[model samples]
Target: MKNYTITVNGNVYDVTVEESTGAAAPAAVSAPSPVKKEAAPAPKKAAATGAEGSVKVTAPMPGKILGVKVSAGQAVKKGEVLVVLEAMKMENEIIAPSDGTVASIHAAVGDSVEAGATLATLN
Candidate 1:
């Protein structure tokens, strides 16, 4: 038998696994107790206009919005950080794809967003 530690988000779990020599099926391991989760509210309306020629900045992964670095009408350069996201206990920065004006911000700080969710637009 061997023991291991696994972390999800910030929670750590102790797990044990046994080695088998024969072809018999291994013992079943009971899953951890399910944590009660509050239902997520419906997504708030995005305030950005989907104007022609605008580029959408999307979330790369599901995470909570940590910070918004630009506002509508704010000028941004390529490679500038546009938003900060916290996923799996790590901070990820989303940057502008090209030099342009921020058309709108669809997410606010503390909002939980999904992967591919539009965060903002640039034009």
Candidate 2:
């Protein structure tokens, strides 16, 4: 099977197709395609406060933290990864909520976190 993304009316659709073979045909053929709807977009991250203030970092999805990139008191960029979470056999890096100092870490490596769970705090 093969997958592809098609755009129609300015909207994107994911489609999968299966290949077919026959003895009489010199070449392969493809079956009818199937379209799969993708999940809705995730909520937007909270606005960044450049000044001194606590920024709540939330998990993007349910997953286990495979690695931690920032420690408390460490300075970070606006989109720096503070943790890496493994979900659906894929590792996803959790970025900092804002450009500031790492105030605290709520979840540690090997810890499982649900979507929207507090992962860290930034100053």
Candidate 3:
């Protein structure tokens, strides 16, 4: 008998394969295979800060910066487009979290950033 372990999507399972001799019957095992429980997802990290008095806005996921709709010191309304990020082959808009002036932009067009990396700041 041969035993093997396989893991997929954080879940692990143990399997056993029995060998049969030529023209002979296979043996049966009574013990059940062991299985490891799946692990839970990790918690998300918080956003990074910018300059003083500015509310930092971070990327929700890793992506390429596609467009920047606002500039530093520009006043933006709540839910206004601040940047466009391309992730998973789709464009995602990064909107302003609240009504405030764009204090600064930490990323530019065509830049790639990691999740929770600061994208901009609103004051």
Candidate number achieving the greatest TM-score relative to the actual structure: 1
What is the C-alpha lDDT profile of model 2 across 60-100, one tens digit per residue?
88998899888778899998988999999998988975788
Return model 2's CA RMSD, one decimal. 10.8
Candidate order by lDDT, highest to lowest? 1, 3, 2
Estimate the Cα RMSD of every predicted model relative to the unseen true structure: 9.8, 10.8, 7.7
What's the C-alpha lDDT at position 56 in model 2? 87
Of models 1 and 3, which has the larger lDDT? 1
lDDT for each of the candidates? 0.83, 0.75, 0.82
Instruction: Look at candidate 2 and tell me the lDDT of residue 36.
Output: 57
Assess candidate 1 and give its lDDT. Answer: 0.83
Model 1 TM: 0.61
Q: RMSD to the native, candidate 1? A: 9.8
Clashing pairs in model 3, backbone N/Cα/C closer than 3 A: none
